[model samples]
Target: MLIAAASTIVLAVVVWATVVNTEGWAAVQRFFLDPAIALEYLSKIWDGFLFNLQVLAISVVTVGAVALVIATLRTLRGPVFFPVRIAAAAYTDLFRGLPFVIVLYIVGYGIPTITNTRFPPIVLGVLAITLTYSAYVAEVIRAGIEAVHPSQRLAARALGLGYVQTLGRIVLPQAVRKIAPPLMNDFLSMQKDVGLVSILGAVDAVRAAQNAASQSYNFTPYIVAGVLFILLAIPTIRLTDWYTARLRDREQMGSIV
Candidate 1:
C-alpha cells in the first residue's frame, strides 16, 4: 500500500510538472480553468445537468423493461419460437453494431421527418437511448439467464412450475446477481450519453457549456461541466466496485484456497 501510494504521488507530480512546463500552459489554464467563468456559468450548467438526470431516470426504467422483454423472447425454447428469437437477435445485432451517435441522429432526426410532427429533444434523446442501450442490455440479460444451470430449470419443471413462473422465481433472481455489475456499467455509460441530447438541440449541460463558451470565449464552462459529470459518476463508480467485490467474495468464499 505504501509503495502504491508513493508511485501514485510520483505520477501525479510528474504529470503536473510536465503540464506546467509547457509553453502554452498559461494560455491553456486561462481558457480552461478560469475560476470566474466557471463560477459565472455554474448555475446555468447545473440547470441543464438536471435535465440530463431527468432523461437518465426515464431511460433507466424504460430500458430495463424493454431489455427484459427482448431477453425473454431471445431465451424462449423450441422451433415454434425460432422466428421470435431471430427477430430479437436481429434487433440486438443491428443496434449493437451501430454507433450510438448515428442511432441518435436517425431517431432524433428521422422520426420527426417521417411523422411530420415535432417532438421534444428530451423525448427523442430518451427514445434513442432506450433503443440503443436496450439492445446492449438485452444481450447481457440473455447471457445471464443462459448462465443458470439447466438442472435448475428441469427441477423447477418437475415441481410443476410454468415457464414464466420458473423464470421469474428460479432464474431471474440469480441472473440479476450475476449481471448486476455489467448492468451498472451500462447505466454509467448511459448517464454520460444523456448529455448527447444537445445534438438534438436540447439545452443540456453540454449545450449550456457551449453557449457559455460562445459568450465568454473561454472554455472554463466546458471544464466545469465535465467536472460536474465526474463528480456525479464518482458515487456510482464506487458503488459498482464495492458491489462487484462483494459478489466475487461471495462466489469464492467456500472454494478459496
Candidate 2:
C-alpha cells in the first residue's frame, strides 16, 4: 500500500512537472535540436571538465597515499604512534569540520595574499579538495585497517614480522579490499565536489554552463550541465554497487568456509 501510494505521488509529480515546467521542457527540446550550439557549449566546457578531472584524480591519488600512511601509523603501538594518531585525528577533524567552499576561498584567495604568491585556480582547487577529503579518507582507511582480525596481526608478529612489514604484507591488502567500495564512493563524491571549484572562477563545467546561460539568456546550458554530471555519476554508482556486492559475497563465502 505504501509502495502504491509512493508510486502515485511520483507519477503525479511527473505530470505536474511536465505541465508546469514548460520552459525547462522547451530548453531540453532546443538543446537536443541544436547540435552545433550544444557542441560549441560542450567544447567551451571541455577544458574546464578536463581540469576538474585532473584535480579530482591528483587529489584522490595523493590523499589516498597520505591517508594510508597515516592509518598505518595510527594502528601501530608506541609513543611515536600516540602523537601520530593524535595529529591524524586533529587533521581529520579540522578539515572535515570546515566547509569546502571556505577551504577553497582560503586556498585560492587567502593563501596568495598571505604568501605573496599567486596559485593557479586549478592548483587551489586541488589543494582544497585534497585537504578536505584526505581527512575522511584517513578515517575510512583506519576503520578498514581496524576491521582486520586481531589474530592476523598477532600471527604476523609471532612470525617475527616487524610492525611495518606486518602492515605492508597482511593488513593493508585485506583492508584495501574491504574498503574498495567506500573509496570508490568517495571518488564519486569528489567528482561531484569538483563543481565547488566554480566558486573560485575556475571555468569548470558548471561555470561554462553559467557563462552560456548568461549569454544565451536561457537555461538550456545549465540543464545540459546537469545531464552531463548525471551521466558521469551514474556509471560510478553502478560500479560501486557492483563492487560492494562482490565484497559482501566474498565475506559470506569466507564465513562459510
Candidate 3:
C-alpha cells in the first residue's frame, strides 16, 4: 500500500511538472482534458446511455436464447435430423463469417430498401447484434458441450433419460456453468456493440456524443462517451475475474450446487 501511494505521488508530481509548461498545458487544457467541457458533454449524453442499456439487455437475452437453440441443434445426430443440423451449421457459418459492420449495414439499410419501410433504429440494432452474436455464442456453447465427458451422456442414457432430457437435465447445465465467464465476456462486448447500432441513427451514447461534439466543435464529448463505456465495463471485468476464480475453485473443491 505504501509503495503504491508513493508511486502515485511520484506520478502526480511528474504530470504536474509536465503541465507546468504554460503554452503546452494551455493547448492540452483547451482541447482534451478541460473539466467544464467534459462535464457538459457528460450531461448531454448521459440520458442517451439508457437507450444503449436497453438495447444491450434485450440483445443479450435474445442472443443467449437463440444461441442455445442453435447449439442444441448442432449437437443433434441421426439421419432424421441431418437437414436440421445442416441448416443450423449454415446459419452459424453465414453470420460468423461476416464482419459486424457489413451485417449491420445489410440489416439496417437493406431490409428497409427491400420492404420499402424502415424499422425503428433500435429494432434494427437489436436484430443485427442478436444475429451476429448468436453465432459466436453458439460456437462458445458447442465447445463447452464437446468438452463434457462422454460418460455423462452415456450415464444419462443408462438412467433412462431421453436425448432431450439428457441434454436439458444433464448436459447443458454443466456446459453453461463451465462457460459462464466467456458468456459474460461476450455480454461485456455486447454492451459496447450496442453503440454501433447508433449508425442507424438511434439516440444512443455514441450518437449523442457525436451531436454534442458537432455543436461544440470539440471532440471531448467522444472522450466522455469512451470513458462512460470504460466505467460501465469495469464492474463486468471484475465480475468476470471473480467468476473465473470461483470456477477454478470449484474444479478443485466441487460444484457450488
Candidate 4:
C-alpha cells in the first residue's frame, strides 16, 4: 500500500513537472536566463529568504526552550504537578487544534489591536510557529523523558539526589539522545511552515515569489521558490536520517556489548 501510494505521488509530480516545463518554460527562461532580470528577482527573494531564516532560527530555539520546560513539568508526577500538567495539556490542545494561519493572524493582528502596540512581522511570525510547534516538541520531550527507565529515577532518589537534580543530571541527558531525531523532524516542519507566515503579510520567500509572479504574470518565480524550499529541506531530511541511523547503531552496539 505504501509503495503504491509513493508511486502515485511520484507519477503526479512527474506529470506536474511536465506540464510546467511545457507551459512555463518561457517564463523560466525570461526570469532566469536574462542576467539583469534574474538578479532583480533574486534580490527580492534574498530579503524574503533572510527573513525566513530569521523566523526559523528564532522559532526553533523558542519552541525548544518552551517545550523543555513544559515537558519537564508534565513528566513530574505529584500533587504539585497538577496545575502544570493541566496547563500543558490545554496549551497542546489549543495550539494543535488551530491552523497555522489562524495562529499567525491572532499573533500578528489580534494582539496589536488589543494592546495598541505593534509587533514586528518577523517577531509575530516566529511567535506563531513557536507556539504551534512547541506542543509537538513537548510531546517529543515527554516521550523521551518516559523512555528513561523508572529504575534510573528510583536509583537517583536512593542516592540522595533530588527530583530536579536527577532529572537534569541523568534523565534529560538520556532523553535528549532519544528525542534528537524527532526534534530535528519538527525543525524541518518549522522550516516549511515559515511559508504560512506569508499570509500575514510577512514578506517571506513564498510571498516574494508570489509578488514576482503576480507582477510578471509568470509562474517561474513560484517554481523558483519551490525549488529553493526543496534545496533547503533535502539536507535536513538527510541529516535526520543519518542521525537516526547513528542512534540505532549505537543502541545495537550497546545491546551486543
Estimate every model's Cα lDDT from 0 to 1. 0.96, 0.82, 0.89, 0.85
58-82: candidate 1 lDDT, tens digit per residue: 9999999999999999999999999
TM-score of each: 0.95, 0.85, 0.90, 0.84
Tens-digit lDDT track of model 3 for 142-182: 98998899999999999999999999899989898889999
Q: What value does the lDDT take at residue 130 in candidate 1?
A: 96
Estimate, for each residue in 100-198, the C-alpha lDDT of model 2 and write its tens digit: 888988888898999999778878888888888888888899999999999999999999999889988999899999888888888888889988899
Question: What is the alpha-carbon RMSD of candidate 4 to the true structure?
Answer: 5.2
Residue ranges of candidate 2 with Cα displaced over 4 Å? 1-37, 254-257
Residue pair clashes in candidate 4 = none
Best by lDDT: 1
Residue lDDT tens for model 4, 1-257: 99999999999999878966587876667754444544558878877888888888888789989988888878879898799899888998889899888888889899889999988888888888988999999999999999999999999999999989999998999999999998989888888889888977888889998898788766667766766778889999999999999988987885763
* Runs with alpha carbons beyond 4 Å of true place in candidate 3: 1-25, 252-257
Q: Model 1 Cα displacement at 59 (Å)?
A: 0.1
Cα error, residue 152 of model 3, in Å, equals 1.0
